[model samples]
Target: MRFLYSVAWWLALPLVLGRLWWRGRKEPGYRQHMAERFGFYGVRATNMPLIWVHAVSVGETRAAEPLIDALLRAYPAHGILLTHMTATGRETGRALFGKYGARVVQSFLPYDTGWMVGRFLRHFAPRLCVLMETEVWPNVMAQCARHGVPVVLANARLSQRSLAKARRLSALMMEAARRLTCVAAQTEADAVRIRQLGAPDVQVTGSIKFDVTPPSQMIAQGAMLRARIGPRKVLLCASTREGEETLILDALGGIDLGNSMVVIVPRHPQRFDEVASMIESRGYTLQRRSALGDKVVAPAVQILLGDSMGEMFAYYEACDVAFIGGSLLPLGGQNLIEACAVGKPVLIGPHTFNFSTVSDDAIEAGAARRVNDAQAMIDGACKLLRDDSERMRMGQQALAFARQHRGATARTMALLGPLIR
Candidate 1:
């Protein structure tokens, strides 16, 4: 199966590059780092010990923030090699670790083939390797085992749907799972799923994202934004996926948002313009975040497009209610924790299997509410908007819930203590 997978990868190489090109039409960063994907890149600061971390995309990259900071503090003498598969992830990594400069290196992780994996391992000579979330590449794990490298899957999670899919490739995934030195799973459910897949060791360390701290700048920005928007109620549609925005807009059309403004923030940066186009095409008057820099929002603005990057915390702070996207479209819900962390009442769509446990717990804890679709979301948000006491009560509950979920970072560090040397 490994050999066949490698051959399939080779065959699909052109298609991979073609897909990048297709996406590059909207996001040019996709075309920037071509050679790095083929395991050909320079390594600086080779004099120090190296720790390699693989975070595939934006969500994983952000989730990895606490772990990376912990590693930096734990091994001050060691240099860190951060590997990413997406342009936004790479950009985020650089922004997050740019201060470290040579101490923190960012590169594209090669495809999962024996030679490519071998070259990547040989180039970095990482002492400890960590993979974020649920990214498991059979060939890469096998290579790590062959090289006697300790690999830890940190903050790991596997939804039931993913577990069923993993079972189809059971032969391959079972071997990969067994090779991991330890699986630091997010929850007991995920740990159970991972163990059933043949991971030799799995530990429930909670969720690292629960430890994420919103920056003070973002909070201040949010307050400033709230002032600009006047006394209008802000309903944040955060980290929305492709089809979810249309649904949210349709729901908005149905509701009477006399003094309420809907803020639509797409999950991917590439979809900003597309989302803006979608809003305009739907006959809604909107304003972009960038355009509102120094100007007060026009009273006619019905929708605010959060087209800027790295300001999610600000958006959360600026809004009275938050409706996390991705849930409405079966793409799994965006991280509701961020909104909750900022003490905002949250709403999620029904298709939240990707974050099932968290979403369910939030709903049960009175920190959040679940809706079936865009109309339901708008209805729920409007109900909360009309009742200040209910929104305020939910917001307080969300902040407390978020605070209670901390300490995962310390727990995960302890779980991987032996491998840190």
Candidate 2:
């Protein structure tokens, strides 16, 4: 099976390179990082026992943060080597954990070719490796197995589409799955999927993201922002992507939110300038968060363009209502869990395949509302704004729902004990 998998990968290398090139044409950051990884730039390991972590992007890195903290607490002597596949992920890591530069090292993961994988492993020599979410690279896993490094899948998830693909290539996937020492899945369905792919010790350890508690500073920052906004209705569009912002602005215009403010936070910081241009072209008076300096909200601003990073939770606190982005278009939506965690009245669109289970649960618990289109989103936002009582009620429900979902981190930590030691 391993031989066949390697042979298949060799045969498909050209097609993979072509697809990456096509994607890189539109994503400058992707192109830049691909060059860095392939060129083996800045790839090194400190001389210490290391625990390697692989997270593809910002969301996965955030999801694995609590666990990373836990691991560091448990093994103070061990160092951490974090690898990301995208430039945004690398930037976020530096922003979030750069303070621990002495202990935690961040870099782009090498490509999945056997030579690159061997070089990466030979340098790091990690005691244990943790792969966050659903990033399963056959060559990487096989190399870890060869090196006798215990590999675990932490906070693992397998969407239906992924499961279907895995089933189609069960033999190859099974070989990779067998190389994993253990699988800690987000849901029972995910565990079942891993089992189908021949993971021997698959377990449903729940999602660590639910266990995250917002920092006090973030809470205080939110309070300060609310005081500055001073009774004006604030609609926060968090983690919005391309095309969604235009629709959201159109919806806001329809509602005619007199003096109310709309805050737009694009998912990637690199798109700040692009999003800012779009906001100006739409004829909305804009005040950038960076340019505002000490002022929470600019004095005569109609639109607040969030052009900074690491302050999403604080922004969530400042708003009365939040429209979770990516759902309006078809990007599988950003995590609505953060909004729910903050107990903000939340809204989402129809497309949420990436977080389907959580979205459905939030809607069923009366913690969130799902809008069908741009018009519906405007109507929903207006309705929520007008009815303060209903808004507060949903907010309370959301907080309670998030509180009830807290034990996943503890469960996942317990599952990791045997493997890490």
Candidate 3:
């Protein structure tokens, strides 16, 4: 099965490369580092021991922030080799870790073929591999095991849907899961699922996302942005996926927003223009976030399209109520922890299986409310916007909930410390 999987990957290589090139039309970052995807990098390797971290995209990259910081602090002599799959993740890495200079190196992870991964292992010679969330690749794991690099699946999660999919490829996925030296899961449920997949060492370390301290600068920017937008209440639809935007726009059509403005930040930057077109076609006056450089948002603008990147925290802070996207259409929902961290009232849709535990816990804690559909999401958001007391109560609960979940990084470090040494 492993051999067949590798063969399938080899056969699909052309299509994969073609897709990257095709996607580069919208996100040119895919085109820029073509060589890196094939295990080629420009940076020279150093004698300093490297700790390689694989964060597949923006959310994973952001979630890895606290762990990465902890790693740097714990091992001052070691350097971090942060690898990502998306251009946005790489850009976000630069924005987050550029201050560290040469101490932190960023690169696109090689395609998960044995040869490619082998070349990557040879180049970095990292002592440990930290995979944030669910980034399991059979070839990568096999290559790392062969190269004597211990792999840790940190901040990991597995939904029932994902588990079913993995079980369908169990022969390959099970082998990969067994290659993991340890798994630090977000919840007991996550640990149980990971254990069922054959991870040898699984521990519940809560969510490291709770440990991500919103930067002071981002908070200040949010305040300034809110001021520029005047006194109108802001409803942020954050990290929305492809099809969810259409549902949200349709829902908006039925509601009279009154004094509140909607800010929709799509999950993928490539869809900014596409979503902007959708909003305009719905007859709503829209303002692109990128266009509002030091200018106030006009009151006539009913929708603010958050097209800019690396400013999610600011958007959360600027909004009175937030609806986490991707759930409206069964896309497993994007992270709501960021909004809760900012102490904003959160409204999510029904399909949050990806973050089932956290979402349920949030609702239980009064930090969030789950809606059945887009219309319900809008209704929930509008209600919160209208009721200041209710909104503030939820916001405070969100803050408290976020605070209560802190220390996952420390707990994770405790489990990983011996392995690192």
- Give me the candidate number with maximum lDDT: 3
lDDT of 2: 0.82
lDDT of each: 0.89, 0.82, 0.92
Model 2, TM vs. native: 0.90
Highest TM-score scorer: 3
lDDT of 1 by residue, 132-223 (tens): 99999998999998887899999999999999999998888888888999999988999999999998889999999999898898899999
How good is model 3 by TM-score?
0.98
Candidate 3, residue 15: Cα displacement in angstroms equals 1.2
Q: lDDT per residue, candidate 3, 1-421, as tens digits?
A: 8888888889999999999999999999999979989988766655678899999999999999999999999999988999999999999998998888888988899988899999989988898999999999999999999999999999999999999999999999999999999999999999999999999999999999999999999999999999999999999999999889899988888899899899999989999999999999889999999999999999899999999989999999999999999898878988889999999989999999999999999999999999999888888888889999999999999999999999999998887778774
lDDT of 2 by residue, 79-99 (tens): 888889876787778777777
* Candidate 1 residue runs with Cα over 4 Å from true position: none
CA displacement after TM-score superposition, residue 88 of candidate 2 (Å): 1.6
RMSD of 1: 1.1
After best superposition, candidate 2 residue 197: deviation in angstroms? Answer: 2.5
By TM-score rank, best first, the candidates go: 3, 1, 2
Q: Which stretches of candidate 3 lie over 4 Å from their true place?
A: 43-46
